[model samples]
Target: MTSVSLVAPGDAPLTLPVAAAPAPARVPTARRYLMCEPRHFAVEYRINPWMDPEQPVDVELAVRQWRELKGVYEALGHRVDVVEPAPGLPDMVFAANSGTVVGGRVLGSRFRAPQRAPEAEHFRRWFEANGYPGVVMPERINEAEGDFTWTGRYLLAGTGFRTDPAAHAEAQEALGVPVVSLRLVDPRYYHLDTALFVLAEDLVAYYPQAFSPGSREVLAGLFPDAVLADERDAACLGLNAVSDGRNVVLPLEARGLAAEVERRGFTAVPVDISELRKSGGGPKCCTLEIRD
Candidate 1:
């Protein structure tokens, strides 16, 4: 398979300092995941920095890549559940934004962009149909797992872009888990999952420049040994990955970070979803882990 260019047109090259990842024994565990087919995926409108209408999108390619990602989960012995795609809701393929699931309860999404607002209802219906009842739809704008990512003991909630700070407290109250608010400084990494990812219960990986100084400090304190991504990987949305403790499946375009993950004692499984990346999403964007 041909890999997409290291950087897209109009994407200024970002070369920053890199750090070595310390490898440690991490056992893999099967997980239950929810994904949506990218049948209607397109770059019709620009809600984030990554979307450019001039950049052509291929729905067929997106579907194939999405299926490959789903297959990766299945091959890893994980259960993959699908939610039907609703036409006109192009971004529905990013199932992670549908909701934040912790302790088996769903915290529904409220999209900040009007174009994606309708997606919440469609996702909510899927949860209900799939036996997830009484899903808490927060009044404040929170893009579900896009902004709210659970890191074992606490939920690392993001703000300053799509999700509101108020939504952080709402999720904490609803999920009964402590929520730590991280302020995203860059539009490119608007979601918490985009900049920070939990690799295991005690380990994580992140792009430091994507977050504010205070937020970065908090992350340093929380996980001092977290794998830090260089600009090349972070630019390709490499930090947006799904890890099953021992295995990490991420965008193939983020090869630099993939190597880092492997050095950190995790098997890095890379898949190309360049078509989907045209809309600012990678592997983690398409996979939502249901913590039951």
Candidate 2:
């Protein structure tokens, strides 16, 4: 496989000052993640309501914030890897949309929008070159981590906005896991990551309003002790979070959700990535958990 540089010349190395926190007892820490530096990140297209091509972005701030997020994972002793950012593909910084990784196999994304289509190949190639050769390209339209997440045993998939429901069957076959499909009703919650989060095997935090009545019922049945996020936190993109069984890394603006997470015995670490939210992503969107 041909190697592609996953970073730019002036991009800062992954190393950063570590401020380690003691891991909570009985909780498993994430060991690996895939991230991309916001070297060429910008709001050049209006793909979502969050993006306004007319407005300008603070490129330097985006880079700084992205690095800080990477640092948080490193501080927690997780391995972070990069996929070189292609010049024209600014949205590539939202790495989670690339694909879903489970059991060392990557089911590549078939992007809904044309602007993000090229990113599928970039992520696929990165995984192929980085030792994960079981990369399955899906026949149906799906946006990997953006619409799919694992619950330690089963696969939770989201559709109705970017991913097609047909892709859920593909996921079941590709990952060899039972797949539960959830329908996203609101456009603001375009991706599943924006509405629901898998905090642990049996725990989840989500905004009920984002899903349809039936989908909401399915979630309720699946996770009886779900942490419900109020409108305030949901609007702030608080539900888009990454958890390591014990600790959840979320946006600082989501105070209500943070409090709820803490009440569940998990330490909530808040990191500000407001600049990246300008492109319709938060902490979870920037990091792709490499389960392999």
Question: What is the TM-score of candidate 1?
Answer: 0.91
Tens-digit per-residue lDDT, 1-292, candidate 1: 2233355588976555545544568899889999999998888999999999898888888999898889999999999999999999899999999899999889999998998999999989988988889899989998988988888899999999999999999999899999999999999998888888999986899999999999999999999989999888899998999999999988888888888888778999998988898999999999888999
TM-score of each model, paired residue for residue: 0.91, 0.90
The segments of candidate 1 whose C-alpha lies over 4 angstroms from its true place after superposition are 1-22
Error of 1 at 102 (Å): 0.6
Per-residue alpha-carbon lDDT of candidate 2 for residues 250-288, written as tens digits (9 for 90 to 100) = 999999898888877788999999999999999999988
The CA lDDT at 192 in model 2 is 94
Q: After superposition, how far is residue 172 of candidate 1 from its true place, in Å?
A: 0.4
Candidate 2 TM-score, C-alpha based: 0.90
Report lDDT (CA) for all predictions: 0.90, 0.90
User: Which ranges of candidate 2 are over 4 A from the true structure?
Assistant: 1-26
Q: What is the alpha-carbon lDDT for the whole of candidate 2?
A: 0.90
